[model samples]
Target: MRYHFLSLVQIFLLTVTTPVWAAEQIVLNYKVFRESLSVEEISRFAQTGELSSSLKINFALARQNPKAVRQYLTQPVKVNPVFLDRVLNTPLGNVILDQISQVIHTPSQKADRQALRAALVLSARQDSQITLIEIFKNYPTSEVEVDGDRLESAYRQLRRLQTNIENLMGV
Candidate 1:
């Protein structure tokens, strides 16, 4: 009877703690193909004033890179660039960027930036609709709904592209 009671306690403990342990084990493993971005690249990109085309392509590539990294990490991970950008553009972004900059200047933050950029891209590619919803929830209430909606639509489109890629890879 004592052995049976002890076994029941052990099972109960495992059931209670397993989920918490599992949740903490879920870490965001970030990787970057383009690990470095120079001031020259930023300045040139900015100066060229091809913001629309450049952002479009960069955003697309960012989506692709993260999935590859996630597969390498062997975990179910999602990357959303829109969420990343929105987060970065917020006070949270400022704090993170500031810390990163203090450790290294903007140009030097290339690795961190690339890692985060890739993560966001991957999230968008994986599940953009859910990502956008999450981003919208995090967004400051002061933001215009129309702007948020537009961004959401963009994320959805990106998600569709990501789905196509997954289908091609048979992942």
Candidate 2:
């Protein structure tokens, strides 16, 4: 049964490594349309505020203001990784993650909460701050699907989370 044992080992390796794929493309989903862009392109725009033709077209079609989008992309929320992890493990944190997951998720729409929590913690651990772009950069998927129509709501949700944390910490 050597052949059977080898097959089982291969299957185990693939299953264990499946979720390690980092996001390469982001798909913005609007009610009537969608557009895909590379993570590099978005990062460049966020850093330099320079729009590639594809981004220009996407923004124009989506009727989004480049400056506002840039601001949202780069806004940083300071966090303590240990505290963040503790908070995220709570029931309230799970509820927040569930709400945010509806706006940002993997292409298959599976493990959304787990992925988002991983991304957030990873981003915060890397730096003391988390940004929208940082979260997307750390997402554990080949493709990230974002609800373009609900971006503002997601931002508000994040802000509320920050406010709640601040209040709890008396900061």
Candidate 3:
């Protein structure tokens, strides 16, 4: 009986103390472009090593008009939708989407725009409303390794997709 109890205790300890292995992760690097890194700023910085004088104020009021904003948003953008779907299914992608949904604690905008933004953010594909280019700027871009078991092909493709994402960041 004593030996049985000791064996049980040892088994319990082993089960309790064993380190659990985490899920597999797929790594990917990407850059997001939002308001701060406007094209004008990029152009000026490229040519003169500094942002334009107008950008110095960086006030919303001084920025482009509604028409210009619309025009800019109307420009064509490109992305890989299939790749995006695979990413959105991943842990890191899910987290990103969750944060975005959290920020939208309350809904105010049109239904179409809201849905499109959510789709574009995860889909990594171009839509009518916005693109990654419009979401981040001069911000730190990093490779993502999502937590969860995934097929080898998924990880392999993600690494391949990273090149295009990195190129976009450079643009």
Candidate 4:
């Protein structure tokens, strides 16, 4: 009986903890990608006449030569709530999709939030949706409906994309 009880306890713990761990990893990936990108052009133009910052300037110079911008966009930067109900079910899903899309897009690529949101809405995979929903839950909010049916959709293409970013972060 004791052995059976221990086994049951272990199974319960694993089942409970697995979701939390998975949720945390998804959130981390979302954060790494979000922090890596910024609206620097707006800030730079506000501060200086140049539309781009020194980073962009350097990137251009490097492009003239041959080096990756990974060194610039990614840096040794040291890195929420419980709204994990239904992310896209509410209006917040649209916001979440846009942010993830922005992360997926090339830094220099000209894309608007709406376009990114639309793309992800159309092509996002399961894991990507799960990751986005996990990231969205950390946001503060009011009463929101949870829609399990819709979030089931997946941006399978993003499966590799998220993995690649997490791998890049070495996290």
Q: Quick one: best lDDT, which candidate?
A: 2
Report the C-alpha displacement of residue 111, candidate 1, in angstroms: 12
**Count of backbone clashes for each model?**
8, 0, 7, 7
Q: lDDT value for candidate 4?
A: 0.31
Q: Pick the candidate with the highest TM-score.
A: 2
Residue 18, candidate 2: Cα error in Å is 15
> What local lDDT does model 2 show for residue 131?
84
Worst 10 residues of 3 by lDDT: 21-30
Can you write out model 2's per-residue Cα lDDT over 1-171, one digit (the tens) per residue? 355455888987564434476789999898789989899999999999999999898889889899988887788878777777888889988998999999989998889989998888888887777888887888988889988778777777777777767776788
Steric clash pairs (candidate 1): 78-123, 79-122, 79-123, 79-124, 80-120, 80-123, 80-124, 81-120
Candidate 4, residues 1-171, lDDT tens digits: the string is 355345888987554333321111111112112112123332233234343454454334433211222211121111101122233335654555454444433233344344343333322232234333332322122111121112222333234434443454465
Q: Candidate 4 has what TM-score?
A: 0.20
Worst window of 10 by summed lDDT in candidate 4: 73-82
lDDT of 2 at 53: 98
Q: lDDT score, residue 49, model 2?
A: 100
- Residues 117-163, candidate 1, lDDT per residue (tens digit)? 33334334445423332222222221212121123333444345445
- Which portions of model 2 show Cα errors greater than 4 Å? 1-19
Rank by lDDT, highest first.
2, 3, 1, 4
Assess each prediction's global lDDT (C-alpha) against the native.
0.35, 0.84, 0.35, 0.31
